[model samples]
Target: MDDNQEASSTKRLWGARFKSEPSAALKALSRSEPSFFRLAPYDLAGSRAHARELQRAGVLDANELAQLLACVDEVEHAFVAGDLHPIEADEDVHTFLERVLTQRLGPIGGKLRAGRSRNDQAANDLKLYLRDKARTLATAIGDVQAALVAQAEQHIDTLSTGFTHLQPAQPIVFAHHLMAHAQAIGRNVDRLIDWDRRSARSPLGAAALAGSAICRSPELSAAELGYDASCENSIDAVAARDHVCEFLFITSMLAVELSRLSEEVVLWSSRQFQWVVLDDGYCTGSSIMPQKKNPDIAELSRGKAGRLIGNLVSMLSALKSLPLAYNRDLAEDKSAAFDSIDTLSLVLPAMAGMIRTMRVDVDQLRRHAPLGFTLATEVADWLALSGVPFSEAHEITGALVKFCEAQDIELGALTPAMLAEVDARLTPEVLKHLTLEAAIGARTGQGGTAPARVAEQIARLKAVLDKQAAWAADYRGPRC
Candidate 1:
């Protein structure tokens, strides 16, 4: 074909409203086929919905509809088999797939676009893409959480110091400290599940920038495609990217949580702390230094969180200036989003592996865990329970701690005579609560760092995760 004929063939797929050819730079910049091909399964899902809708609207006979659907299936198979190559001439995945379908089925394939447009087509593809991604991410989060719970279960009785403002504030089981991470990850998983539900609405049939004149049933398409409902307004359907924004926001939040956990890992693995030893598989040796097992992965995971946040901010900024209906500026949406998703994909699995393989030194943890008067609060709590007012109890505990500090004595090491010197109310029974185990055990309230409470919370979280796993398995279907 000649240049003009080739251009006409490509432009014909775009519709007849344009009178002049787009500049080469504009066409080059406008391409989304490369990225869309990376998301071929999602495009195929949207194609399946569009083809069924066309068949329902009498645009194609049963045989033609079957042929078109079969062609779409062929395209997906080609993609999976590595035979499908996205062409540079194709503007986007939606256009590229339609071009391929037209080539395979001729005139019948052309009918698949009867009540569809790139506006709605792109929207639907993104929704399906996020649904699958969100579900996968939720599972990944669950895996990390499981690792955390396993660590907590193994160390439930191991005493450790819990910190507030970087200072030891109280005694807790090592398992309780680990369970806090699990709870944070569990909440992140919940966000992903909620995002999937919010993103379940189909955006099909919102042709070009408005509702199609053809009697296409988006609701039927939605049902067939496993969506909860169809979008109500075409303009808003095409213009809205809130679903994508929400997914990225949840991802950003996850990244923040991961960063916090990573920071802890980095600190714990450092020479200063020596509280844990990361697996050789998860740590790197220094180039010139003989004594370095660097927590580089943790640092990288922590650093990437800023990038995820920047991605969310960039997309929000891009959307901020755009007018109603589709705009070219919206094309900037996928890069940052795709980058953030890719970063998290790598970070989460690596972090999970790191956690699963790392070894915690209970002796070292205990040695450092009890420093800086971690049991001070327990002393105050004990005093209060023994008929002293809380304010007075706190003052007495503070003064006793100061006296112990001057004498180089731990709270547990204080003799009854020394204890009685600080307060006449001090008794043998009160000293029992001064022990780390007793202090932690005494905090049996809901959400406390007591072993029993942490165990209960873990079971509840496990049940929630088990249900999510089953739902995710069903979501993945027989392919899983």
Candidate 2:
């Protein structure tokens, strides 16, 4: 093509309404903002639904509708095979896709946008993209939970130290600690379910913040796209971005939970703890230090949590000043939201792999389980059960812990004379509760760290994972 034809070909779909092309600064911002290549399939799906809406409203004849559908199908296929790419003059995804369509099928393809605006079209595309991504993300989280539950199942009886404020405070089964993270992940799954249900509604027919004057058939498009219902208010449908914020919050919260667990993985794999040895395949060696094998996966997962939070905050900032109608600012929403999903897609399975392959040193865990006076709470409870008031029992246990610490003796190795030094009310029976195994077994309350309770909790987590796995596996629809 000649230079004039090439320049004209680069012109935007909305350029005819303007005197000349948009300013270079606006084009630069527009190019970076939407980043809608990822949203291409979603945009096409929305277009297919909208095309039929147009046909039903008699905006397109049967022949033109058939031609448009055929052309859009080819565009979708080229997009999927990575052959289609955007031009510089292509303003956004919508403009780029239209350029491709009009290039293939002439002006007939232009009728597909009848009675619709980029406002509702972009909003609908985001809903579709998030709905699919959320389902996949929920499944990735479930896989991580499954990995945790599997590891916990094997170590349900292995003893370990439970900490509060980064200090050892109690003795519990190691599986109990793993299951705590699994439970947090289960709640994250719950949050995804709630978020997906809210996002399942369609916003396609809400043209530009108002109901369309012609070619309106939201219900038809909603059903074609597998939405449960259309948005109740057109303006709210076009302008609403709270769903995006809520989705990012769920992702951010899930990241925080994983970061906490990742921190523990780092601590456990350290030489000081030596409680769990990460698989060599999952860990990395240092450049200079010959003895270094670092838990980089866990560390990176922890570090990437900040990225998720930043994405959430960036979206909130984008939504902060926008008015009810759609603004150019809303186009900035997809980049961060899509990146958050992409971040989790990388983090979750790698995290699961690290957990599933790690080696647990049961002997080491059991050995140090009772070293830090972790059984003090058990002794206090035993004293209380022996007719001493809990307040007095608490004081007695505190004195005993202090004495053991000062003498460099473990609570279990304390002499009867050492016990008598604290309180004459103490008897040999208290010694029974001083052992780590005894301390772990004594507390059998619901959700406690006892082995049996840990087993029961694992079973419960498996049930939750089972449900979420089915949800993840079945991508047909969630209306069931």
Candidate 3:
């Protein structure tokens, strides 16, 4: 069919015969062609399941089933090999695949749609597609987690300043801070895995917003397709794009987290901080300036997260006003979903590269990490232990901090005599507690930033990561 005729035919697929053509703007806005290529894998996967179901229901004899399966395989191979490109005139992947099958296998190929509607079929395809994508994304997240964990372990003994409200708060082992990020990403991976389980249902038999009258069993199709279950209701199956929304939500959250890390990279690589140095390969020089090794990749990762978040908001807005069942508005779903997936695919690997290559300047981190009287808490605790009221201890420490600031000396620089001049209760042993090592070592509580505590956390994180690796290895498509 010509492009206009093809567009008209697509409208016919809705079970209505329009007397006039669709307006050009509406046609363009409602077009599903860009999403067709992305939907092909889903179409192929669902077709495989349906072919098996047809065989089970006696709709196709064993010989005919063999021919049909072969034809499907050929189509998949051709599409993958780039010999069968999706036509712009095709309404969606479903239409394109049907057209290809009918053209290749003649009348026998037409039977593939016997008990299936685009409603259930499209839903099934999207589910299958997202299931696989989630698995792959889970792996990527795990890789990034592993990278962070490795860095944390390497820097466990490396002292750095931990900040609160953009000011140095305390001295901490750098690994302790890095491992916190690893734990956050590890949770993200778990979220994706949980979403995968929830999304692992087949919607392939909910034909045209209602259950099909055909004798075929959806359970059989679900089993063949590796879905955990068939969707319970026809209208809910076709109308529900919640799975896609959930996937996008998780991805958007992950993007936000990644952006936060990227912001740190950007700041650390700056001349003002210089605590971390990105590799020459990852760092780019400004075209106009001769002395600029810009953290462009990190900045880009941070910026791209906005796009991911925007896509999620756009999708939610699109679905908010729609009534029950499928609408042409639902065609808008793929662009947002596809954009999120594509943006994440780009971001995860780029971030992985940055993390793997970036260098942490231990000396620089140590020098500035201990600035701003970060050992003040240790001083307050010392006074509180010596029978001073906790609030009074805090005030006394603040006074000592102001005194040290006026003299251009750190709290550690104060001698026992100098400390005693400020607070008569101060002793030599109390001064020992002001040292950075003593301060950090005293905080040996569970989940503390002490070196030993960091080591313990790293060991636990390694065990969790190993279990995730095993799970990824054992995954054989979606579970039923």
TM-scores, all candidates, are 0.94, 0.96, 0.93
Q: Candidate 3 on 81-163: residue-level lDDT in tens?
A: 76777555565677778877776677777888888788787777767777777777777888888788878878988889999
Question: Among these predicted structures, which one has the highest TM-score?
Answer: 2
Which is better, 2 or 3, measured by TM-score? 2
Residue-wise C-alpha lDDT for candidate 1, range 1-480, written one tens digit per residue: 221224346534764788787788988877773555666677787777777777677787789878887888888888778887766677887776777777778888677777778778777777777777777788888888988888888897788888889888888888888888888877877787777777777888788778877636888878767788888888988898877788889899999999999999998898888888999999898889998899888999999999999989988988987888998677666776678778989998999999999999999887866688888888888788778999999999898999899999888788888888887777666777777778888889999878888888878878887987876766631121
- Cα lDDT over the full model 3: 0.79
Of 1 and 2, the candidate ahead on TM-score is: 2
Candidate 1 shows a clash count of 0
- lDDT of every predicted structure (CA atoms): 0.80, 0.85, 0.79
Error of 1 at 49 (Å): 2.0
Residues 1-480, model 2: lDDT tens digits: 221134358646565767766787876866744456778888888888888888888898789888898888888888888787776676778888887787777788677778888889889888888888887888889888888998999999998999999898898899999988998877988998888788878998898888887757798889888888889999999899999999999999999999999999999999999999999999999899999999999999999999999999999999998878888788767887888988999999999999999999999999988877888898889988999999999998999888888989888887778788889988877887788878888779999988888888888777877898777676643211
Q: Give the TM-score of candidate 1.
A: 0.94
lDDT of 2 at 344: 92
Native-to-model Cα distance after best TM-score fit, residue 26 in candidate 3, in Å: 4.7
**lDDT minimum window of 10 residues, candidate 3:** 2-11
Instruction: Show where candidate 1 strays beyond 4 Å.
Output: 1-12, 15-19, 427-429, 476-480
